[model samples]
Target: MTAPAIRTGRAGPEGGSRRLILDMAARLLRSGGYHQTSLREIAEAVGIRKASLYHHFASKEELVEAVVNDGVRFVDEAVAAALAAAAQAGPRQRLEAAIAAHLAALHGHGDYTSAAIKVFTFGSGPVPESVRLSRRLYEDVWRGLLAELREAGGIAPGRSPEALRLFLLGALNGSIDWYRPERFDIAALSREFAALVAPNGVDAAK
Candidate 1:
């Protein structure tokens, strides 16, 4: 995939230098992950001195905090829009719409979304309370979506909504590791994932 363009100068049209830095940091973090990424590397990638990077962000953790939050916000907004657009649809369809929106956001905002998932899931060390809270808010969106499906009897009889949320999210987020648009598409992937909640339930491969 092509790298996100970083506008230069003290005030870039792309939300200025701060935005540029975050974009670059997210891309690097997606590839190197949190532990492997550093302020210096982000600075270099953005074509700025480490000292200049410090002007925008005091520390590496601070920079990552911003990127992680942006990541969640991007997906959150996309799913919200999808749900709103599908308001008249049945609970199952609404849920499927949410899944499709989520997949689109994950792949579309590749750097930010993947960085958020990688930092939270694979980064070694304590995850900040701020990061956890941000994630919880995003999770609540899924909780609400799943609750609607449960209330409408759209979910499989034996599945726990909470467990299903985790399972579905795990599959969706885990796609970052192997999902390739060239080989397959997000729309088909969303349908296959949504099938898990179908009344008959989907059979797992033995």
Candidate 2:
């Protein structure tokens, strides 16, 4: 299958300014979550009039949708690359690559990526549909990987891949609350989590 589209800077009239708005929006969303972030704040940070910000996005929800899509696309691409590179590796290695990619994608890609974890919730707003769609898209990718591990007996006998999926995502996503980049990096978390879920205490087949 073709790869997911990786996010890049936009180009057009006032494209640079628009990108700045999105970047600030992402940062505020990451720091304060959905309800706390406001379009006015985003505009002020972008050094544009509120009306000018509206030139790029009609509503706050619209701007947020773009940010969420960008975040999902990034991790989607990162995980795809990790999985592809591990094509010849064992299922355990594949899972390791996936875990590492996930951690790397979450924290290091700025607020666009981190904001995803922070503001990700279903709500009665323009964002709910987009939120669900973006999440399902990313989840489906990881689900495929877990299914393979399940088929190979790389998952525990009593546990299902779906459960593992929830566990892994929940754990990784919660890092926004306390993850200290100075103290721990994605590689370390990846290895630690990989060990935790290593199929009934075994990393791989003997």
Candidate 3:
């Protein structure tokens, strides 16, 4: 099933009150973490009354569920689109395409993606089941991609698909903290990472 599209642009007044609230919520959640963010803060950020937030989301958890899901959906769709574009390409090429797409989406939609990661990673409170499910679904996409690469012998012989997937995603996601657009290009970063993990060990051709 197709997930709802995440608003990638600024949510002006015409963008619908709900979307504007989501945009602000994601930004706050990204900057302040889940616990540090509040419904009143999100409402204020969106220039709406705190009571207005309830009209869209019954509680803070419900609002967070939406933001977290949107975050995963945005990257999942980006990677899916990139893979479809490279459907006829070789496994290595396809992997590179996926990497580039993931990085682009990660940095391009930093607020949503970063908030999702930080909320999931550091939140000490209970997480909604739907939010966990959404994350698992997105991770499955990478698992499938890595499984394909392993089948094609693109991964080292001794490496497990799950291990490689975790490592790759961890490294990629961690870039949100240190990646500098002026210092590095997403395409180059993707190629460099792909080469590092390629079976042949630093195969520029791959």
Q: Which candidate is the best by lDDT?
A: 1
lDDT of model 1 at residue 186?
Answer: 85
Q: Candidate 1: deviation at residue 19, Å? A: 0.2
lDDT (10s digit) by residue, model 3, range 1-206: 57455443444424477877888999999888888898889889888789977877988888998998899888889899999998887778888899999888777855787778878875688878888887888889888887887777778888877888888999998887899888889999998888877746322333
Q: What is the lDDT, from 0 to 100, of the residue 146 in candidate 3? A: 78
Query: Which window of 10 residues has the lowest lDDT sum in candidate 3?
Result: 6-15
TM-score of each: 0.88, 0.85, 0.86
- Highest-TM-score candidate: 1
Candidate 1 achieves a global lDDT of 0.84
lDDT of 1 by residue, 140-166 (tens): 999998888777777767889999999
* lDDT over C-alpha atoms for residue 166 of model 1: 91
Winner on lDDT between 2 and 3 is: 3
With a 3 Å backbone cut-off (N, CA, C), the pairs that clash in candidate 3 are: none
Question: How well does candidate 1 score on lDDT at residue 26?
Answer: 96
Model 2 Cα lDDT, one tens digit per residue, 63-110: 888888888888889989998998888777788899888888888866
Local accuracy by lDDT, each model = 0.84, 0.78, 0.82
Clashes of each: 0, 0, 0
